[model samples]
Target: MKNAISIAMMALFSLCCAAQNISVQSINYPTRYLRHSDSKGYLGEMLSDLDRQDASFKLVNAGIPDCPNCIRFESVNYPGQYLRHSNYLIWLSALSSDLDYKDASFRLVQGLAGTDRVQRTTHADVFR
Candidate 1:
């Protein structure tokens, strides 16, 4: 039981590390405690974890946009499948690039106005 728990946690850490251009850091996005976010900066499966050990997290968005194909995710019992999808990771990388561009643009705008910019920082979605 102890080894299994350790392995599961390790898999979770790897998922966090899968973010593009990610820096080495303590991975702590436990699916059990994740709260939903749709702040444009948030990503990953709409649902966090379904296991009884933790609460299941769903997106916090009040309303769904008219997007045709909403992204969905199902947690896997296996570690390998939990973090190895090309298209999913590719989408995450694109989201990261988009966030970088958006942040820079906002900073430039604030700098010219001589105003202290409010930071809208977000993590690079680990799905990438």
Candidate 2:
């Protein structure tokens, strides 16, 4: 009975962790997914196994102090790197400063086109 209870608890914890892992896909181009290469973010097709890994990200709580409701996308492959917008362009970078935290933080809202999808809005209001 003890072993069975432990196994069930472990399985529940695994499911919760897995729920936070995701791949951002483009609505217009469903076959393309958001990926990072050369520290730049791009919507590209998953042509190889590495591409799939590059596209995967863990949805984590915002790194900023004030925004507990916001979220950040941490690259699964790169570990410490997160998706951040700079100069109107998105890039995968290692966050260090308050500015970096703000840049990386985003809110997930209902898609403008439809409710079936989600849209990411940046704290700077620069990217949608």
Candidate 3:
């Protein structure tokens, strides 16, 4: 019974990690957090902010079993949209069939020890 309960708890923890809210921070500018502009548009709208609410994003799985690390980020305040990089900038975009080109996929990685930085890498293998 104890082992079964432990397994269930572990599964729950994994599920939480699969759809966790994370803040993307700039490694270069440690004080800044990745953020989308107030305007709801694509391209040239990526920026950084010091506010946590503006920086928070829900990181969810892209549902590709082959690529376990492939994931998408959704805004906590906005629904039905995912984070994508356009023109080397970040923006929230609706779901698209062209997953390869939509640039909506990313991989979350831990930064150095004792730091609050999280790195997001797109499917193109570009870091943001």
Top of the candidates by lDDT: 2
TM-score of each: 0.18, 0.78, 0.60
Candidate 1 lDDT by residue in tens digits, 1-128: 44443453344334433532111111244332221232111233334333221212111111114321122221222211111123222111122344432222111011222233211112223223
Per-residue lDDT over 5-118 for candidate 3, one digit per residue giving the tens place of the 0 to 100 score: 345334433653675576655656666666655624222223434245556677666765555666776777676677777776666767766753347877544444323433
Candidate 3: misplaced stretches above 4 Å? 1-20, 39-50, 99-102, 109-118, 124-128
TM-score of 2: 0.78
Q: What is the Cα-based lDDT of residue 9 in candidate 2?
A: 35
The weakest ten consecutive residues by lDDT in model 3 span 39-48
- Pairs with backbone N, CA or C atoms under 3 Å apart (clashes), candidate 2: none
lDDT (tens digit, per residue) of candidate 2 on 9-127: 34433433475567888989999999999999999999999999999998777645554436788898999999999998999999999789889988665566664555778866533
Superior by TM-score: candidate 1 or candidate 3? 3
lDDT of each: 0.24, 0.77, 0.57
